[model samples]
Target: MDAQTGSTASAFPPGFPWGGAIAANHAEGAYLTDGKRLDISDGFPRGIKHEYDAVIDPKKCYPTHEAIDFYHRYPEDLALMREMNFRAFRTSINWSRIFPNGDDDEPNEVGLQFYDSLFDEMRSRGMEPVVTLSHYETPIHLVG
Candidate 1:
């Protein structure tokens, strides 16, 4: 069976929403900077030898210190997406970027600035930006 030979039927109306997906810990790299506190995802051990067991050890973990380095390279990244004629981009914002330390008197300005620029770039490129508040990596302080 081939997808090209499959029957075609209108499952829904046209103009449906379609986009890519990304996660905080898997994308954002500002793990413990700019007032951002460590989250449980940071504590999850990486490179597990067994594929069917659960392991949680902060000491043995390797946090995504520069996962894609999107924080500093978002402009270029957005440009690449624009080249692809993306109608929308789906990404998650780091909770720590907004509420560093989990609870604070106010949100961090530097963190906010990055997002502001990102959104502006997306709009300027004629692409809509879809944001997820917390796909993962909730500040450990929020656990209790």
Candidate 2:
């Protein structure tokens, strides 16, 4: 047995992928704005809903839709993250933002452009981006 039984040494190698996590509905807003359609996340109840129950009307009561407003405020947020020396950012895509109706022949150009700009900003700041295809905000249309 070693003299020092407990140590704070790390087992992982250096530069082992450090980043932050962000959810779609929690970060990006504009849920029903622009060309985006409503998603299941948008329909979630304002305060709390019973288990196995759907949020009938989202527009009226929901905690998100403007949670952090990252959609319209990503530039500032990215800059802040850069200042914090973030090496990477892990965020999910808003299915509704990309495919408003969840089943479309083409993706929304504006939505694509927004993400492009976001990635560019991250790269410009010497940071890597890890994208998650879907977190929790699946388009409501897909439920059917």
Candidate 3:
């Protein structure tokens, strides 16, 4: 409701581009699957609140490690988005997914394929993808 007029807004404008957004480190799991390797986010069990773990702890849970399993379940997830009339989606390319070690001479083929399939799937569903090159999760190999 508008404070001045005490009227409620009808709805968003047509073609307003309803959609969703996700960061790779926050959505995609499979941190070590395919040719992928550890990223800066891999060691942080509690996000940025505490210092990053020197090594991954078996007993500690890292949210990113299995976050919604988006890596393997994107088709299902995208279908849900399509059902909601989504016309756009914002997501990131995991830096380590492409360059597993962050300094590899060549990009990982499997990783490249995954994103290719993901983008293609999004387009197939009539959703325009807005991609972020990275989302602060640098490859762990490059951090140390």
Candidate 4:
């Protein structure tokens, strides 16, 4: 183990992959752009620890509203991840982005395109994407 980093050199076997993960609601920030609509995460002004507002209070600031701007800056961000030698990335698919109403008969095409591009970007950078169908951010329309 290295004294400074406290990490053993070659701790795992050869070909071991290293990567990072992120939740869609915590990264994607195009909130209502395109055909997307509000989801459960839209009301958490102070994260999951605090009580979510009964409705979206425009007065309160929500971090997920613009979290990292990853939705738009993913190319640059994925490049940075490649620079760090990340071989895999785990991320969720924002359910509401695809089915804005949760029960919609057809999916939103633009949303599908966004993810297709995102996954293609990762593959282009030699990063394998591990995708989750959904995270905690359910479409608000379903709750109504």
Candidate 5:
């Protein structure tokens, strides 16, 4: 009997954890602002994968430069996240954004301030922030 045969149908419990995420090299666009500079990500070309050298040219479109412009639009973006009922928003912190050249004696003040505001916005909207420290946005100089 259909009523007699019963089993759990869902994989997770109700109100299960759910969220959205983006890496620093994928969504942020403040690569040159606030005492920032090139990271390894700046070398990758847009659209498709290719040899690193082939896409390193500057004549072609760069993905990070206009990557959703999240660096500037995060407040609005976070608001949208709240609308989606996101339990947490995960995004990486561009290493270069915090410490330009990856060897500066002091961290960039503007860069530090940006994150303070970002996290505040998230908490204010009842959304938790999950930040990544160096997800492929490592300063290029450090690598070289």
Candidate 6:
């Protein structure tokens, strides 16, 4: 066991959660482009964390707006993750992506299609995809 990094390889029996993670806001960047609305994370200038109602820094670049372009690059990324022995991939499905503004007349089919394809790819590689409901990305309209 390494004292510095706490590498506990021999401690686990089997089925440990070896996973990669991504927030919907930080990874799925089709933001408001495909019928998506403004999620709270859309206003978060800091990619990691910020106030619940933080005002976005207009001058600063918004990383979440692009967010590695996961919406379009999941296939290549997931293949890399499989190569890394990632047994599970964890990612939040952006609520706004599906519902537009949290409370919509109906769910967005395009958003649902994206997740379906993503999970299918994961399953094909024998990887489990853990979905988070809200990863600090509730639609901006819902906070009030």
**For each candidate, how many residue pairs have backbone atoms clashing (under 3 Å)?**
0, 0, 0, 0, 0, 0
Question: How well does candidate 4 match the true structure, expressed as C-alpha RMSD?
Answer: 3.3
lDDT of 6 by residue, 1-144 (tens): 879889866665589878789888888787767788888778766544544335666676666788889999999999999999999999988898899889899999988998899999999987898988888778888884
Error of 4 at 96 (Å): 0.3
Please rank every candidate by lDDT, starting with the best: 3, 4, 6, 5, 2, 1
Model 2 lDDT, full chain set: 0.80
lDDT of 3 at 8: 93
> What range of 10 consecutive residues in model 2 has the weakest lDDT sum?
50-59
Q: Candidate 4, residues 99-128: lDDT per residue as tens digits? A: 999999999999999999999999999999
Ranking by TM-score: 3, 4, 5, 2, 6, 1
Residue 138 CA displacement from its true place in model 5, Å: 1.4
State the number of backbone clashes in model 6: 0
Q: Kindly give the stretch of ten consecutive residues in candidate 6 with the minimal lDDT sum.
A: 46-55
Q: All candidates' TM-scores? A: 0.76, 0.83, 0.91, 0.90, 0.85, 0.82
lDDT of each: 0.71, 0.80, 0.92, 0.90, 0.82, 0.83
Best by lDDT: 3
Q: What is the C-alpha lDDT profile of model 2 across 64-129, one tens digit per residue? A: 677888988988998888888888998888888889989999999988888898889888987898
Measured over all alpha carbons after superposition, the RMSD of each candidate to the real structure, in angstroms, is 5.0, 3.2, 2.8, 3.3, 3.0, 4.6
Better of 2 and 5 by lDDT: 5
Better of 1 and 6 by lDDT: 6
lDDT of 3 by residue, 1-144 (tens): 888888897678988888999999999989899988999887888545867886988988888889889999999999999999999999999999999999999999999999999999999999999999999779988878
Question: Where is the poorest 10-residue window by lDDT in model 3?
Answer: 45-54
Query: How far out, in Å, is residue 78 in model 1?
Result: 1.2
The TM-score leader among the candidates is 3
